[model samples]
Target: MAATACRRGRLTLPAFLIALALAPVVGGRADTSFDTGPELGQRLLRDVVRIEARDLAEHGFGLVVGVDRDDVYIATARHVVARRAPAGLVEPERASHAIAVSFCALPGAPRQLAAMLDGFDGADDDLALLRAPRPSAYVPELKALAPAGKDGVGDQVWQLGRESDCVVVPTPGVIAGRPDTRHTVRVDLHGALGGASGGPLVSGYGIVGLVKRSDNEVIRAHAIAALAARVRALAGPPFLLGEAGNIPPGDPQAAVADLTETLNGYLFAARDLNTLLRQEIVPRPTFAQMVQRYNGSVNRFKAARDKYDGTLQRNWPAGTLPQWQALRERLWRIHLRFFGLNGQSTTTITGTERAPPPVREQMAALEPELAGLQSDIARFAEHLGKRSIDHAELSQ
Candidate 1:
């Protein structure tokens, strides 16, 4: 249905200078299920950015999704700045200067930052990313819904944008239908949506979608979870936009430091698992105890590993990415070996209750390997520290 709307010219792609309006809902009936609080609306306003491409003579709305190192990432609709290519996908419109993004939250003067078009996730998702230099001022931390699926029918949502008079207005809506297409969801708004394409669709405290298009009462938004993955793949590093705060401001070293913290957790968990597998305990624990301990250790290790894996590694020093990736691979191999030692399949470590014969010898064999990996990691950290010092010196 959406595909046909675009092709037949029914779906109006809002451009600059369009007089948009939102008629009041019939009977002024409100959905009593959920109420978007004023406090949340104020917080969301901080990240609502108005984008203007002077060269293309077009303007649209965008959300400040992330700030990574020196870059601030903004998410907007692809059609806002691009036309359909021959292949049906979209490409960035060549411009003389960067697209101007105005942060409405800044007090006094409205500061506009120049943002470069990063990339797009084809026409299906209809999402694009704009990357700009991080401002000295504070950036709002936007949380994204984890499972950004398009299945939230009847769930209340609020779309924040600065389309009318450049003021952030919160439009309440409820997810109406399941989009047959992937990476999209339909929302029936209480009021007609204006030219706010590329704004955020907030549900609760987290952003669930990016407003893509609207037809009177109903609008389509690109789900944030899917948009996150697409942006991660396109932009590389700064993988999780919402988790940018996890890394410090001074990047490269900041990323390295953050990674080291996760690795430390992994080391502690691995040590516990190793000690348990070797049966090196004050009181020789029973098989059940061993199983419980093993499961617990595995969970901790996996958590740490995932944290390390999901980090923004593109700016990690310079040559440290390969080393870190190698270390991650080695850790993964060790995880697989763990299941092997327990006589369990790597795929099915879930609800593992039974224990195999004593894996003392196998566990013993992995000690040297673990020790070697630890030594390598230590060297890696040391290298990272040296590189940080060198970088700081170079900058000076």
Candidate 2:
């Protein structure tokens, strides 16, 4: 069903292909009469987040619906947080599991934070709330959409979702019908995909429902109006649109420390890629083993690049330090050589059945760049008086 395809805890080949095909295609805008233009869509993204369970392979999208003076509350599908139990009861695993809530849309905000389960309304409601303390630096001013009163059939609506890559986007649709049982309202959105479940269904009026599941044509969502009280109780007081929580001044030393850590992580991944190019490829290992190792290296490189880019976006120590700027430029050049465009890895081997000659040649070509990057990173670490963080540490 659409639920499995859309709420991706882990990316499968089929889901990745589907996401590749449709993720770039943006849906039409909502009616301009209600001021639901590009500006509003961009603003809504500030409150949306991609949720991941730390203990389990469960991932989905959610909304920061309530931000009190001290904390922020996130709402998502219960299935995203807990596994289903027998006799329609929800599992208690959520209470013990640490969840990661990430704000991908808001720039310069803490990219991810640890959240804990705040409340749940069981299988019937299919709704869950999570709470995380507001950060000491820059809290996102959230505009929580209030539950709309009595949404009728044929009303225009929008469902917000995260693509497999965790880019928040909106799918426009309309309310088709209200199912009498289970407090679900069906939506006629055609673009809902995996990694989109647990997103909000909003209309010109307000938040109409929370996404439950979807088939080919219709999407079933838990009506927010029916459980509005529970939501309020769980999320605490509603979020004010303009409320700016306490934002402390930036700490340059702390930022530099974080930047150094992120750089180390990136360099670590880069060194691994370099080793794969040398030890795995040049040795002419079996095709299967080569493919497997190449795939693993691609994943590591992508993750490292994502983290490095995200951290720099939040706080780039290179902006003020000339030496750091030079190091950053070198890193970017290496990153571009490995990841040419659209974030696709140059050394990726898509199908294991056959390792194309062109791919093999490309892998061979990347060796020099990878080796040079490792050397440059090591020298940069040494220049910063941190010999322990050199490329030699990759051995440990």
How does residue 294 of candidate 1 score in lDDT?
Answer: 42
- lDDT, model 1: 0.57
| Model 1 per-residue lDDT tens digits across residues 103-208 | 7676554556665554554555676777777777856644334233423566566767646434435557887865545868788974655677888776543566
lDDT of 1 at 113: 61
lDDT values of the candidates?
A: 0.57, 0.53
The candidate that wins on TM-score is: 1
C-alpha lDDT (0 to 100) for residue 249 of candidate 1: 25
Model 2 stretches astray by more than 4 angstroms? 1-34, 37-39, 86-96, 108-111, 118-120, 137-150, 165-171, 179-181, 234-396
Alpha carbon deviation, residue 359, candidate 2 (Å): 77
In terms of lDDT, the best-performing candidate is 1
RMSD each, Å: 23.5, 21.0
Candidate 2 per-residue lDDT, tens place, 1-396, comes to: 112221112433222122223123244322111223233444466667778875668888776766767777777887787766666675644432657777746545654554555445555577777777765553553433533433667656676665444442445677888656778888886756556777766654356677877766777888765655566554344634321111111222223344444566666655554445433234223333433433443344333333334333344344434555566667666644444322122224222233345544555777676677667666655554432222211210
lDDT of 1 at 266: 62
Distance (Å) between predicted and true CA of 147, model 2? 6.8
